[model samples]
Target: MGGGGTAYLTGYEAAFINPANLAVPDKSTRFSIGIGTAAGFFAPVMSVGSASRQFQAYKNYLDAHQPEATAITASEKQLILDRNYPKGRSRSEHQHRMDLILGGIQWRQGDRAFSLTARTRFSTRTEVGRGWYDETFEDLDSSTSVRDMSLFQQSQFLHEFSFGYGQTFDFVSGLIPRVGKLYIGIAPKFILGGSYLDLQYDARYWFTDEMDQPLFTRSFSYRSTGNFSGATRHYTANGDPSAAVQRHFPSSFQQDFSDYTTPTGMGGGLDFGLVYVLTLGDDLSLAHSGNTQPIEKSLRLGFSVTDLGFVSYNENPRSLDHARDTTLTPFAAASGQKYEGSPGQYLSFFDEVPDLNPFQFNQVGRSDDSPERPFKAVLPTSFNAGMLLQVNRLKLAADLTLGLNDSAFNNTKLIAHFGMEFAPVKPVPIRLGAQVATDSPTLWSLGTGIVMKHWELSAGAQFLSPRGSPALNLSGAAVGGLTFHF
Candidate 1:
C-alpha cells in the first residue's frame, strides 16, 4: 500500500524497502521462505482514457504507420518544435521498471534477523524530445531551412546479491527510550552488471529525402558498456555506428542469468534505516512488546537511505562516436527486421550539449579510445520518510520519497503516498491508497492480501485514469507477490 513498509516489515521485503523492519520481531515464524515479483510502467500521457485505448496507441507505434505529408497540420508542426515530455509538458515522465526476486530464507530471534535474497532489476527511461517527434512525423515538415534537434536515452539491467542484518533496542544505558522501541537494519548488496547502454545524437536538417536524406548533417555518440561476457561481433571492424545497430533489439526480460559469471562490473551498496515506535497505552512496554503481536505500537516514524553505491565496469565495452554529412543507406534485413524509423529515430541523450560528434575509434581491446577500463556509474540513491499509525486492526500510513539527485534514474520523485490497511477478519486484510506528484496527480491504488496460517498471497495496482479521469497523469503497471511464512 503506497510502498509503505518502513516500520515493521519482515523477510526479504525489508532488505530493500526498509531494513529496520527486519528487526521488529515476527509472530509468523523464525524462518521464512518465498519468491515474488513486481513489474510496472508509467507514462504521463496527453489524454486520459481506458487502458485498452492507451494500449492501442502503443500498438500503433509498434506497427509504424506514419501519416502522409498531406495529412499534416500547422498546429502539429508547432508541437514538434517544442522540446519536452510526451507532449511538451515541462515536467513529465515515461518509465518502465521490473523487479524479480528469488527469495531464499530469513531467520529472526529476539531482536535480530538475517536474510539472503537475489533480485534482477531492469529499468529504462525515454524523454519524448522534439527530435523524437521529428522522427515519427518527419514527412510533415517539408522545409529546407535546416532545423536542428537532439535525442538522448539510457537503460540498465543488473542482478543484486544482498545479505541483510537487523536489530532492535528497547532502552540503552546512555540513551533513554523516549519512544517505546528503536529498530535499525542494514543490507549490503553485491551488484552484477549485465548490460547497459547510453546513446545521444544531434541532427541538422529539415525533412527526409532518402537520396540526400532531406539535406542534413548528423553526429552520434554511443556507449555499449558492461555486456561483453558472451560478446559477438555484430558490426564489422570498419566501426560504423549505424552498422552496429542493424540488428533488431527485442525488449524483454532475459530469464537466464547464468551468463553473469565473469564479473564485468562489480559494485557494493547497503540500505540503512531506523524506526522509532511510540506507545500510546500504558501497557505498551518495549520489554513486554516482544511477546505481543506486531509490537503493539500506536505510532511509528522512520527514515531510510538506499542504493548508495556505483558499479565500475572493467569489461570490454564498445564506445562509438561518429559524425558525417554524407548520406548513408538505412539498415534493413531480409528477415523482416528494420529500424522503426530513420537512423536518428532510436537515438536519445541524457542532457543538452552543444555538439555530440567525436572521431570514430576502432573497438579493439587495446585501443586507447575504447580501452578496457573501469567506468563508474552511480546508483539511483533515494531518501524516504514515513509514518504509520496503528489502531486496533487498522493501519494508516503516509510516505514521502525524495530523489537525492534531480536526475537520479529511480525513486527520484517528490511524491506523497497515503494509504490505509484494515483487517476486518484476522486471516484477510484489504488496502486502499493514493499517490500524487507535483507534475502529475490523481493516481489511486487498491489491493488485498490473504493469510492462511503459514502462507501469504497479495496483489495490487496503481492507476492514472482507471476511472477515465479527463486529466490523466501516469499510465500502466500491475504489482503482486506470493510468500510463505513457514
Candidate 2:
C-alpha cells in the first residue's frame, strides 16, 4: 500500500478492480472466482528508502548490545548481564505480508461482450543485515570505521494474465424509436514470471593505525591505553575466528528493492444504463381517475485506464575474485610495502557468489545466460454504477463504485461503494453492502445466492479494520477479498 494505488469497488473484487464491471451481468454467463489471504503488521520506518539500509544495519546491532542504564549493582548488573544477555533477545518482524488468488469468465452476445481472467500473486519479504562489506580500521574514525559496507539479502516472485471485451448500442433504431443503452469495454493484459537475488559480505580490520597492540590490551587484560581502548571488536572480511552466527531470519528479507514488477497489462472502457416501468389503476374523484404510472432507474457513469505496462530489471550484482589469493607479509623492505608477515596482505569482495558450479547471468556477449526480463509498474483504474427494480416476484439490484487508484478526490473520490439484492426468501438471493472511504476502513458487506435449477451458488464478505492502520488510522482496515459464484 506504499504505491500503485486502487479503491472503488462495485461488487466483490469488482472484477479484479474493474474490467468494465464484467459487462454488468447478474446471469447469462457470469462465473466469478476469488480466494483471499492476509497477514499484517509492518513497522520499519527509518526513511530514505531502500529500507533505510536495513535500518542502518539493524541499528548497528542495537547500538552494540543495548547499552544505557545506570547506578550499577545487581552483581554489577549481573556481570553486565552475562556478557550482553544473549545479545538482548530481539524478534518482532513483519514489514509487509500479503497473499492473493483469483479467477474469472464472462461471455455475452447480442450487442457484444466477453471477459477472461487468471491471476496469481505471491510476494516474499525478510531482509535484515547483509549488504556488501569489507572493512578494517583500528581508528580511521567515521564513527568507528567499517562504513561503506554492503552485504546481500532480498526477495521477489510474481505471475499474471488478464483480458476483457464489451460492446452495446441503441441510438433510436430506425425512425422515432426509444433511445437508450450504450456500453463499451475493452481489457487486455499479460504478465509473466519472476526471480532476482544478489548477496555477499566479507569482513576484517585492525585500525588504531593498523594496530600492533591495543584491542583492550589484546582481548581483556582490562588495559585501556587507548587509540579507542584495546577491547573493541568489529570485523567481517569473511569473519572466522571460529564462525557461528545467525540470530534469526525470514520476513522475505526486504524484497531486494524493486526495479520491475507489473505481472501484466491492458485497457479499455465505457457503460450506460436506463430502466423505467410502473402502473397504478382504480377509479376515483374529480374528473375521475383511470390509470397512472411512474418508475425510472438510471445509470450513466464509468471509467477505465488500465495496466499501461513496463517492467525490466538488473541492479549490479557485484563480483571480485583474484584466484582466491591468500594474504602473506610479516615484514619487507624496498618500497614493495610490507612489514608483518607477507604472502598476500588481505583483500576480498563478493556480492552473491555461490553455486561454484551452475554459474548464471549470461547475455552480455551472448552465450545464453538467461533472458526474459521485466520487474514492476502498474495503474488500474475504475468507476461504476447500476440499478434495476421490478416487483413481480420481488427483485431489486444495486451497484456503485470508485477507484482511480483509490482516490484522494480526483473529482470527488471517497471510493464510495454499495450493493443490495433481494429476491423473496425462496431458492435464495440476498446481498448487502457499504464501502466508504477517505481515511479508509468503513466496509460492511454480505452476499448469498443459490439457484439450483441450472447451477449457481455465490458467497461474499467484506468487513475490514481488524486492527486499523493502513499506515495510520484507516480506522479498522484489514479484511480483504473473498468470493465465489457460478
Candidate 3:
C-alpha cells in the first residue's frame, strides 16, 4: 500500500516491513502463508519537465538520422548537448528493482509471534555524468577541460532466508501513561549472493584546437569485479565488446535463467522494529491487568531499521587503472571503416591514443599476486517510521523512509508515503496511496483485494508523473500476491 505498511502490516507481511506488528493482539488471523512479487524502474533526474522534453528531442534526432549516417554532425551534437545538459545539472541516474517473495509463513500465539520467509531481490543503478554524455555524442568542444567525468554502474541479486520473532509487553497504566502495549521484533537473515557487479569509469580530457584536427590530452580508468570478470578478460584480450555485454545480458532465455540461479557469495543481515499502540477508552483497565485479550487501538506508531549488513564476493574480480597526459589528434575512421556512433565506438578512441595502456591492480588487499581478492558490497540500509490510525472500517497510514546510504538499491533521500484502506463490505477492501520525494516524480497508486475467510488475493498499480507534467508516464510498478490465513 504505497510503501506505508510499516505500522499496519501484520503476520507474514510484517516480516520484511516491520516485524513488530506481528505480535499485535487484535490480528484476526493467527497463521498466514503468502507469495508475492514486485518490480519498478525510475529515473529521478529525468522527472523534470525540461529533461523529459530533451529526452524526446534526442530520440527524434536519432530516428531522423538512420542507417546512412554513422556519425552525428557538429550542429546536431551541439543541439543535443544544449538541450540535455543544462547548467547546474551534471549527473543523471536511472534505477531498477525487482523482488520475489518465494514463500513466507507466520504464526502468532498469545503475545508472541514467529515467522520464516524466503525472498530474492535484484537491483541495478546507472549514473552518467554530463561530461560523459557529451563525450559519447561527440560534442566536446575546443579549449575545454572535462574533469571528474564518470560513468558508474552497479547491480546485485541476493537470496535471503529470514527467521523472525516478535513479542508484546504490556505496560502499567500509570508507569507509561497512555501507552498500552509495546512491541519489539527482530529478523535475522542468511543472505546468498546470487550475482554482483560494480563498474566505474572515470575520464579527463583537455581539448586545445578545432574538432576535426584537435589536439587533446586524456586520461581514463576502468574498474570492475564479480561475474563480469571473465567477460572483461575476453574484451581486454580479444577486443570483443559483445562478449562483455552478452555475459550480463544473455540473448537466449535458457542462458538468462541459468545466470539468475547461480550463487556467487554469502552474507548476513538483520532487521529490527518497534511499535507502540496507544490505549483508548476502556483499554486502560486491560493494560493495567496485563491481559492478553485484544484491545482496540485508535493509533499506533512504528519504527524500523532494515538491511544492516554486507556481502563479500570472491568471484573473479578485476581492477584497471591508467593515466596519460599526452596530446593526440582527433579521431578519424580508417579507410572503408564506418563510425557506428555507438557508445563502444566512441570509447574506443581512447584505445587509439598513444602511450595510454591500462594496467590491472588489486582493489581490496594490496597483494599483487592475488587479483581475485574478495570485494564487499553493502545492502541498501534505511530507517522507516510510520503511523496507523483506525476508525471503524477505515484505516489511514503515513510513512517516512530515510535511506542511510546511497547504494544500488537505495538513495540518500527522504521519501514520504500516505495511504488509506476502506472496507465498504466485509469481504472486499479498497486501497489508495501516494508517494513524494525530493527531486523525484510523484507516484499515485490504487489497489483492491478479495478477502475471504481462508484466502486472499490482491493487485496494485502505481502511476508516476513529473511535478509539472500534464500526464503520467509509463514508468511505475505492478504488484500482486496470494495468501492463505487461518
Candidate 4:
C-alpha cells in the first residue's frame, strides 16, 4: 500500500524497490529500464479551512492590493483557523517536512539487475506539547499552567548517490501445495552522501515582538558536520551562544557553500529480497510474486530489506562538544527518521551518537578538541514483508514496513499499506492503495501504467490530500519515465 513496492514491483522498477523481481519478469519483454523523480511533504497538523477558498481569497487580494501592506482581518482568521495557526494543542509531535528524490532509475534483464539513484531530503519538526500552546501562539505565559511543556525542533539536509547490482536464484522448497523453487535476490550497493547542516532548538520562555520578545532558546544545542571551515564549537543554552559564535566560527561560515558537509564520505549498502510464486489452475504457470504473468497463479509471498548499510565519513566532522548532565536523556530523530524501538521506541538526530549526554550550561562551551572522530552515520533501513493474491488481470498486495533505525538522512516508522493493480484493459493498468499507519494515515493513493508495443510507463503518488479533516495524510510519490521492454 502507499509507496511500499517491495513485493509487487516488476522488470526495470525492481532494481530499486526490490531487485529480486528483476529475475522474474511478468508476461512482458525480457529486458527493461527506466528513470524518474518524486518529492513530497507530510505533517500531522491539519488545516481547518478549505484550501481552495484560501487560495482564491489570496489571489483576489493580491490582484487588488499588496501583500506587504494588507493583513488578514479577524474574519479571515476565523474562516481558516488551520491556516492562521494550528488545530488542537501544539505537541512535540507537530512536525513539518519536505523531501526530494531525483534520478530514481533501474535496469533489469533475466535474473540480473542494476540501479542508480540520487536523493536529497530535508525535514524539521517542533513538538509543542500541551501547556506550551498558549505560550507559543497567543497568551504568552509559561506559568499559567502546571504542565511541564517544551517546544523543541530539529532539521537536516543530506544527499545520496547509490549504484547497485543484484542477482536472483531459485531453490527447491516443498512449502507449497506442490514442490516449488523459491526465488531470492541480493544487491550490493555503493553509496556516497553527506549532511549540509543540522540544527536543534528549545524554548525556555515565550513572548511576542511587542515585548523584548527575544528569540532566545531556553535549552538548546547545535553541531555542524558540514564544510564549514570556521572554528567548530558546540553550544548549550546556559551561555550566550551568540557570543561564542563570533569567537569560534568565522563570518564566512555562511558565505561558502562548498564547505557545507562536515564528514563527507563513501560507503556501501545492500538490498535483499525473497519471492515464492504459486500456480493456481489451468496450465500450471510459475508467476512472479503477486503478478498475473505466471501461467495461472493463486498466491505469492515476498520479503525484502532495503538500504541496509552506513556511510563512514572519514573526516572528523564538527560536533557539539558541550558539557552536560549525567542523566540518561534521549534525542529523537527528525519526525520521519527511523530508530530501534518496540512499537513506540525510535532513534532520532539525538541518537546520532550512542551517548545519552544532555547539554548543560556550566558544563559545555566552545572547544577546539572534538569528540566525534571518523564515524559512520547509519542509512535508513526498511524491512518489509508482503503477500499478493492474483487471478487473471487482477492482483492485490499488502505490505508491512518497519524502519530499522531513525539515524538515516531520511526515516519512517512502522507503517502498513494495502494496494491493488488490475489491468482493466489487458496490459494497461490502474492502481489504488492506502496507508494504514496509526499516526497520520492517508485514506487514498493511485497510480497507472501503460504498456505499449515496445515499452511501459507509470506514475503516481504514495498518497496525498489537502490539509483538512478526513484528508489523506500520506506522503511520497514514485513517477516513472520509460521502461523500454526488449
Question: Where does model 2 exceed 4 Å of error?
Answer: 1-32, 35-95, 102-150, 160-191, 202-259, 262-478
- State how far residue 413 of model 2 sits from its true place (Å): 44
Per-residue lDDT of 93-204 in model 1, one digit per residue for the tens? 4454556786656778766787898887766554333443344333344533333344445556777888888777545412745546778889999998766655555554
User: How many pairs in model 4 have backbone atoms within 3 A of each other, for residues 3 or more apart or on separate chains, i.e. clashes?
Assistant: 24
- For residues 168-244, write the lDDT of model 2, one tens digit per residue: 42342123233233344555556553332222222222234454532210000100011101111111233321111
Candidate 4 achieves a global lDDT of 0.49
In order, candidate lDDTs are 0.56, 0.31, 0.62, 0.49
TM-score of candidate 4 on Cα atoms, chains taken together: 0.65
> Which 10 consecutive residues of model 4 have the lowest summed lDDT?
338-347
Once model 2 is optimally superposed onto the true structure by TM-score, how far is the C-alpha of residue 177 displaced, in angstroms?
A: 71
Candidate 3: clashing pairs of residues: none
In TM-score terms, candidate 1 sits at: 0.71
Which runs in model 1 stand beyond 4 Å of their true positions? 26-28, 44-92, 130-150, 170-174, 177-179, 200-222, 226-248, 251-264, 282-285, 289-292, 320-368, 406-408, 411-413, 465-480
Q: Arrange candidates by TM-score, highest first: which order?
A: 3, 1, 4, 2
- Candidate 3: which stretches are off by over 4 Å? 40-87, 134-148, 170-174, 202-226, 253-255, 279-297, 320-369
| Alpha-carbon lDDT of model 1 | 0.56
Error of 1 at 363 (Å): 16
